[model samples]
Target: MNTQFIKASLFAAGLLLVSTSFAQNKNDLKNWPSGYAPLEVGKRIAAHFIATPHTNFGRPTPPKVITYPESCTWYGALKFAGASRDKELLGQLAKRFEPFFGPEAKLIPVPDHVDYSVFGSVPLQLYIQTKEQKYLDLGKGIADKQWGPPEGPRVVAASHEFYKQGLTWQTRLWIDDMFMITALQNQAYLATGEIKYIDRAAKEMVVYLDSLQKPNGLFYHAPTAPFYWGRGNGWMAAGMAELLGSLPKNHPERARIMKGYQMMMASLLKHQAEDGMWRQLVDDAESWKESSSTGMFTYAMITGVKKGWLDAKTYGPAARKAWIALVGYIDGNDEVKDVCEGTNKNTSRQFYLDRKRLTGDLHGQAPILWSAAALLQ
Candidate 1:
């Protein structure tokens, strides 16, 4: 056979396999294809998390690769722990963050970025699982650094630029910050039972959502970047759910936040491609299917369903489809595929259009865990 014929044959076979796998009714839990268990998916992602050398929960930087993505990995680890009866799995995950379990161990937190607060959850999750006062103190302390009495909240307000007439990331209005800032604040609220922490997170959610959400329900990547970057909207969705989880029903802003989150999901469902993934540029027909955002969006959708924040009849099947499609991206070794690498706000739509893809990136791995945990719930 000629080279072109061989390639075509292989492609055709791949399509057949995927078609058979996804042909079942997604809403029928009994009919979900084999090997799609949420626990199994969580385990696959966790195996990768164990091998990951990016985080050191005990110190400021021992694993040589700590960042918000690493923090996200641990957050998912906590979720995985919750689903499994295995306390050891939870412990194994918490040990990495043990450095923050004590008062003496201090983090040299990254400044002027919501990513810094995102990392606080590493310790905070440990505190939740262990109930060690030190972990709680550590979590709250880390939180204070983000929105604490001294300068944390002020810094974010001053640093985060609100969008006016144009789309931009230079201001804090970017959708990605919605998750980064709220991750820390929500965890802090849980750790300390402090209304202020939750308030800080809740307020930021409104700020970002109001500023970035488009008339179509999706959000722009930033003021200058008008493109609907898939992962950025994923961040907004997940962040909204996280905040709502902590916000009380009586809170005045809960209604607005919930309405916006629901509308966002509606928009996302419309854009979901035939294979169950969203494009890098969410609304663009020509853009390539992206995974990290798919994973984050999966986390958002399943979470909303579990929390009763979304209509199960409408979102349940969509969540299942998203999860199944995302599973296809994992290799035998547990590495997530097609994850867009770390990104920044860009003035041009083409910047996101031409972004590079990576495997085993924490941005993808962490959200997969979060989604799997919720699905199993």
Candidate 2:
């Protein structure tokens, strides 16, 4: 046989093996890291909470929304914990935030607008794990209120932010939206058997992806920007990981979306710094290595390996190296260090590099959790 034929035969055999393994061990497949219980990491994270004069119940709340990445990270960890081991500690975390819903949820000042995208996800995730209608209802209300009409065949904006005293589409679709909105929408679809949520998410994701693609197959930070942000790419990558999990295997969009992921991964691999961490702007080495983006990308690559979207032989070593570099950014308590604080929309290279780095920030921690979760799998 020719080389092409041999390669195709091997690919088919690999798929067959994977399918057989999955069918044989569906329950065992869900359980990760042989010999380890689910949510063990979550319990460890919860135990590290140190009550400060400012934080209530030892829960650390940084003043900025970017700092709250841990909330979502912990939220994911909680869900995995709940699913694998029937733990209630994860549920308690959701309950503590219940009082903050509706009129009680306080708004932060920096962004001026309530980040429904971020807030919406955690409650929705909680709803999935607990089967609690209240959490679902709360998430639905927020989603409904914030969701922007579909912009075209593919674009939708759930909210907008103010930049340069003008109302730009706060809907400036970035990769992060995949994590914040698509996952929630997918869960809603599963919970309600509603096609609208999934339909909307799919359309919006396509629009966002189309707008960001560059000639080199890498995605830009936004529609108008030439720069590619690592975290932004990470968001989209991680988003694809989640979407693939939920989407049916035969969905028409599946092949195209998977191709897009492969192309992006190819470009991303080329840009990884020597240290294994990606800078704020992926192509610029002058920019410092930032943990949030690196962790998210690591999570994406690792998930790709688990899902068979990426070749483990090719990407696994890179991911492992990135994880080691990422661990260096974590402090003693697993708090993330040298994380870029929340940034406004910027179109320049300097703008990306100049974003401030904060230690033990939640934005970094959440991605760290995601990376850890992926590694565990």
Candidate 3:
């Protein structure tokens, strides 16, 4: 036998062994401990979200237009409902959107910035689950407008410049844009099976990855902000996972995005605290443990392991421990605690450290549902 042939055979055998282990580990997640079951936890969170009226970034006063945080939490609940196969819960979730179509139509946000465009994700998800034409139209419209000309008054000066480069007009270099922009486009692709939607998302992702991802595989809060703010990085982690979960396997951008994703996951695994939580400032040991970032990272890891992108033995336990640790932070009210408050990019490390930790914020609530739905899937 040729030497090269023998080496190839050994490599192939090793891959088979790893694949088998991943399948077994994936099934093992089903045996979760009491109160840690993903379906149960998801339903509880979904119920809480349904009962709670929409608020602006977790504030009691509802915003005039539905914003990204609430939209994200809504999307999470929808995903959980679909994953758990809870028709009643799904119907209830649908009811929540009925108001948006009627008396609250005024609340639909104009698609200008990345945040506003993300609102499309909710309706796109609804259309997928229910095949409602109204949902499809609403979602696809919002997504299309994201790539269209400036409709809202807040267009950045470089908006057209970004658009000319085959990116969204609303493209901003914030790490959060990875999720806010790609997620909506990904959803639009899912809903319509349109290559354009996914292509646009993939293109936008590569740009952000090249511009923002640091040598260490984590991202700064912004170009000017050097700190690895946990939730900010969490957004990137979740975004890459979301896009990869759906992007065509043979697509040109898949390999690059996957590389970026795996690099971030490795860095995240390194930074995970002994408690299985990640700190608000990811690399800062003294920073407080944060729920939102922990949940987002857990979601990403769970996705990677499930999809066989990660080595199951290495990531399987980490994902599970992080999920359990994240649940422990949920208060008696079903609200996740220790969520860093709505953050803006700042160069000051003290600003991130001193930020308020809120309970029941949709920013926190969303990721727990994401992880739950991911595990269930």
Model number with the top lDDT: 3
Candidate 3, poorest ten consecutive residues by summed lDDT: 22-31
Model 3: pairs clashing at backbone N, Cα or C within 3 Å: none
Candidate 3 lDDT over 92-153, as tens digits, reads 98999999889999999878788888999999999999999999999999899888875568
In model 1, the runs with Cα more than 4 Å from the true position are 1-25, 29-31, 55-65, 99-108, 149-157, 160-171
Name the Cα RMSD for model 2. 10.0
Scored against the true structure, residue 63 in model 1 reaches a CA lDDT of 52
Candidate 2 wrongly placed segments (more than 4 Å) = 1-71, 83-88, 101-103, 106-114, 146-170
TM-score of each: 0.84, 0.74, 0.92
Which 10 successive residues of model 1 have the least lDDT summed? 162-171
In Å, residue 162's CA in model 2 sits off its true spot by: 18
Superposed by TM-score, candidate 3 places the C-alpha of residue 288 at a distance from the truth, in angstroms, of 0.8
